[model samples]
Target: MAGKSKSLKWFGKAVTAKMEQAQILGVNQTMAASAAEAKQNHTWQNRTGTLEGSIDIAEYAKAEADGVHGTWGARDIAYARIHELGGVIKPKRAKALAIPDPKKAGGVILVQSVTIPARPYLRPAADTQYPKLASRIRKAFEKASKKK
Candidate 1:
């Protein structure tokens, strides 16, 4: 009976270690999958590739008592929010916004504001990948338990 307790303790430690590793793997895989989905599935064309390049894991996963947590998105991009959620674009420091118009003389047009439609990238990516996370972690945990 005493030997069984010791064995259980060893198994507990092994399970904890394996769970931590699974957490790390899940976080990394989710981040990568989300980023790729956002980049590849978007319909909008990227000229500078700034927004696309900015999409990444903003906060890496940290193991917590409950589980692991992290964040992934386009960081340090001013237009990222506008592109994602979309809204009206108005001139900030000028009278009217100068927009490129090939048909115009100077290939530009001045307007009061332009309405942008919502083209969510991050949210959709997250939704697609979130469901798989649990399965991944559970599989890892099961594999660890099967080992000596």
Candidate 2:
């Protein structure tokens, strides 16, 4: 009976460890998928290649027995903000820039008001992946639990 109890305790610990590993794996997979989807969306939305290539995943915190934490985004891209949560991009009044006109000879054109419509890609990617992630995590947990 003492031997039986010891074996059971070991099995319990093993199961817990497996669950933690599964959770971390799931988080990593989700972050990768989210980053990929965001990158693809950036292309589909007709964005510059800079923003598309900037999408990436990073582990924000150490994984523990409970779970893992991480972040996926274009952290290095400066224009990520304008694409993610868009805002007006009006030209400075004092700095009214001039551009060479192709239609005329040595003529220049003054900069004018510009508006950028919101083309959110990250949040939408997260929203689309959220529903499927729960099931993926469950599957990962089950797979880990079944492993010896």
The candidate that achieves the highest lDDT relative to the unseen native structure: 1
TM-score, structure 1 vs. true: 0.80
Off by over 4 Å in 1: 1-10, 146-148
lDDT of 1 at 38: 93
lDDT of 1 at 51: 92
lDDT of 1: 0.86
Query: Which pairs of residues have clashing backbones in candidate 2?
Result: none
Give the winner by TM-score: 1
Model 2 lDDT at residue 104: 100
Report how far off residue 53 is in candidate 2 (Å). Answer: 0.9
lDDT of 1 at 19: 90
Estimate every model's Cα lDDT from 0 to 1: 0.86, 0.73
**Against the hidden true structure, what lDDT does model 2 obtain?**
0.73
List, residue by residue over 60-136, the lDDT tens digit for candidate 2.
43475546777788878777888778776656665665668999999988776445567788998788776776677
Instruction: Please list the Cα RMSD from the true structure of every candidate, rounded to 1 decimal place.
Output: 3.5, 4.6
